[model samples]
Target: MSTAPHLEAGGLLLIADESLSPALVEQAAPVLAQGGLALCQGPGSPSGPRRLVLFDGKLTPTHAEALRGEPPALLLATRASDGRPSTWEARLLGDLLRGAPLLPAGASRHRLQSVADISAAGGAAARAVTQAGGSRTAAALVADVVHELAANAMWDAPVDSRGQHRYAHRRSEVREVAPEDACELAYAVEEGRMWLEVVDRFGGLRPGPFARALGGWG
Candidate 1:
């Protein structure tokens, strides 16, 4: 079993957006409650003061109207460009939690070997932070962001082609895999910036908008 880094406590406050499925909402509720994080619950109407507001898909006019009264401490909206399951929802949540405040994703760090290892790579990275005594405030953010972008490269990149699969994660850099199906991933911390790079020899495919969006989270 993998041991995640130690997680600091600020408490996660999850505001379920209207777009979230009942199942996901249910799952998050217990997790936050267990962690002692406050869960914001009220009428769906957006009118009111709130720390943060999360929505399932694009905020509809009604949703927006409700929010007009409450500017939300932060706004998170999900959208599916590739029609992948929960990918968009995950992206929105990651973005709001990270407070990235930027558009257009970052550049690639390295080429990855086989798409199968994206989850493993991300999981490893998140585990490293948690085990290293990082903040759980963004633990899920780091994990999901890395998992989605890295996983996208594996499934979307050409089976024979190889391009650098790079990503920026919490206070670390990662570079993994190149020639062999089993490449290396590197993570380092510098000047309070985390870097993650993945190197793969196969070079020829381009990432799609959906994958690109996920990568741009930072």
Candidate 2:
């Protein structure tokens, strides 16, 4: 059970956590191979840098908090309720595999200065996704997603010159986002999908907590 990532120049690797079902992994691997990257397969062991662990059980934010950006990123796969793989994010994953980010460079960008801006962004996102033939249930989640991400950018992301938290202590204030300290949101709609990206100039997002809280978003 050496669950280290298959780090031998393979582009994308599919591996499973010991707790993840073999059937789920078997069903998902080839289905996601079309991204056209140099994908590979192997049973990566647990605990290491740059590990993409798949599992079937519920995981907590603490799990994500533990990683703390040592690997800088991760992706986890789980079984769908219908006993198949969940491909809801396949489009985004495909885009990532293709080496494009910010969810496509042409995504529309929005500036966030207040809660109203967050709501507007979410509403527009949901509309674009639903109108593109995406699932309404999925579209409904846009608000929650955008809200949390935007809140992070406005509150948790900002720091003073000494890297001390600036707005983190004033969330109750819901302080107006200064022009130079605003969160930037970008999104794009496709035939049956859409991507949302939030960016803050601070560039100090913590991966672990983000992973924990956002794990079940998609």
Candidate 3:
């Protein structure tokens, strides 16, 4: 709903439907302008790179599918009937528009195997973040998030020929992550934001699980 004071100007494009309430637009205008972005209301598509198309209503599955191949980053904003953003919707928009890296430049990346490797990668990322002027709390939070991401990639991602998760039953115990099942960890700090990403080679995340997680069903 509001922009962070320390955010650096970054290129952004917000596309909202004409049906969106003027009140909502008024609330979002300053935040969008503060981020150095342009906002357009209409059905017409705009041209350019680093543009983020923001759907300013409930994003149905069919609508999401239709926009799958569209150019530019797609961010959905689901608002209540009264035109107020839900907590998750607000957070998602804040993260996207806060000038953080979509992909960090000059990031430190590591191929991590085993719990020890996860720890090392997190420590390295924390150091990088702090050296870039991130607060100690931010560094610690980034490190913790990286650790959890790495753990999920290592212990919950392997699939077998029968389509069963190889380590699902053993999630509670620590186990060595084989080199073949290793995950990639990358992190960087830019413009007062710390960016962290974990990549699992299996690419086995399904929509059902993702939806459930998002809905806090687990």
Q: Give per-residue CA lDDT, model 3, range 1-218, as digits (tens).
A: 12121112233444444345434544555555544344444233333343333345654443333243334245545354655444434444555666554454687889987878888998998888889887899889988999888888888888777878877688767567667888888877766767677888798865544344444432
TM-score to native of every candidate shown: 0.31, 0.68, 0.58
Candidate 1 displacement at residue 155 in angstroms: 2.0
Q: lDDT of each model, Cα atoms only?
A: 0.43, 0.65, 0.61
lDDT of 1 by residue, 100-119 (tens): 52222442233345444665
- lDDT score of residue 68 within candidate 1: 39
Q: What is the TM-score (0 to 1) of candidate 1? A: 0.31
Which regions of candidate 1 are displaced past 4 Å?
1-116, 160-184, 205-218
Worst 10 residues of 1 by lDDT: 1-10
Off by over 4 Å in 2: 1-13, 21-28, 40-49, 60-69, 79-91, 97-99, 102-106, 129-140, 210-218
Give a tens-digit lDDT track for model 2, residues 47-155: 3345444555456553464345565544655546754445554445666645667375578888998878988998888888877787888888876898899988988
Better of 2 and 3 by TM-score: 2
Residue 124 error for model 3, in Å? 1.0
Clashes of each: 43, 5, 0
Q: Give the CA lDDT, 0 to 100, for residue 183 in model 2.
A: 85
- By descending TM-score, how would the candidates be arranged? 2, 3, 1
* Best model per TM-score: 2
